[model samples]
Target: MRVPLALLMIATPLAAAKRPTVAQLQIQVKKLTEERDSLKQRLAATDSLQQDLVAAQQARDQAKADADAARKEVEQLKANLKANASGGDTLLKDLEAARKEAEASREELAKVKAENAELRQQVAAAPREGDLVMLTRDVQPARPLNLNRATPHIKASGFFASRPTGVVVVNVLVSEKGEVLDARLLQGLPGDSPDAKAANEACVQSAKNLVFDPATSKDGNTRFKVWQGVGFYLD
Candidate 1:
């Protein structure tokens, strides 16, 4: 009986030592749950960060496209401005050529009027049938006797002062005594302005002051008409 009781006591202590407590098991389970929750939260945060990165990249690409479109618009405007400038230059050249042509036409018209007046004077000066007795005598042609003396009067006139350079046509009738009987302006410069009229009148006055050599024809008749063109120039 004493030996059996000692073995029973040793068996009882060994069984109690090997058995685990409920508090220790509960603590281990709580620690494992916390570790799983932490891992899940980390994965969720990483997904959100990736989504934000994608959105930013898309915005950047759109901005680049907008910038390219704006640059193209600016280039087109510059090309249009250059084309307009070139067209304006062409228009200016056309205007200058037109002005030169108009000036040439005015000069030509003045020359024609003067030539017509000169021809009329020649026809009137020809001998008539009633003057046959005067035509029978030997005569000399009419010629200027004081052209150098008359030129100074024309230069000092109001007509020459207005148009310093141009042509004036005058018709003069001279008597047998070498005296000017009549003088008139045939044609003058291009315009009929006040200055041109004054010039014409001045030319007529100058012609009246002229003296000529006796114009004796086959008949010694010195009465004749003459057409003259005088040019004025500024030195």
Candidate 2:
């Protein structure tokens, strides 16, 4: 009862799968068509995206131009501000200079006023012209009046022309060099007549011609100023 190997092999069936039905094949075809339509929709969206990118680039260029213009405007404003500041500083300096000048002018005016007051005081304290004020006793020369070398110079012709009959005294201020610097009439005639005035002027003139010795201090050595009197008795 042993069978042949070839006949046993033929009796064993192969493990092959069954074939697909027609309806299943139709469902697969439908899915592949839907995928193709979705791919077409995505490809159409790429053109719109490209247009948006172009618009964005144009907007970016316009924004850059606006920013440049704004920057230039800001720079101009800064320059203007700096110029105004310079002008303000110059104005302040000018004001300060004017104030200093005013102060100087005020000081000068004060000095002028002080000088005027001093001059007025000096004028009040000075002696008047033709005053016969004698030197103080302490400062007078040793011989205040020296009649020697004075009588020879007197003449009758000086007062005789006026026909005056009075004594005329003249105050002569003698320098240390025995020179007569000034002569003033101390005593004249009793009346103020024309002849009396003439006689007084003649006496003053004659007194100036008189010579004298050098004046000395109380110690009789130091040269000093002195005053002398010359009398003219006219008849």
Model number with the top lDDT: 2
How close is every model to the real structure, measured as TM-score?
0.33, 0.36
Local accuracy by lDDT, each model? 0.46, 0.49
Report the Cα lDDT for candidate 2: 0.49
lDDT tens string, model 1, 115-183? 445544643566542221121124343566666455422233343454333445564555666677787
Q: Per-residue lDDT for 143-185 in model 2, tens only?
A: 3233432332222344444355545566567776667888877
Each model's number of backbone clashes? 6, 0
lDDT at 16, model 1:
46
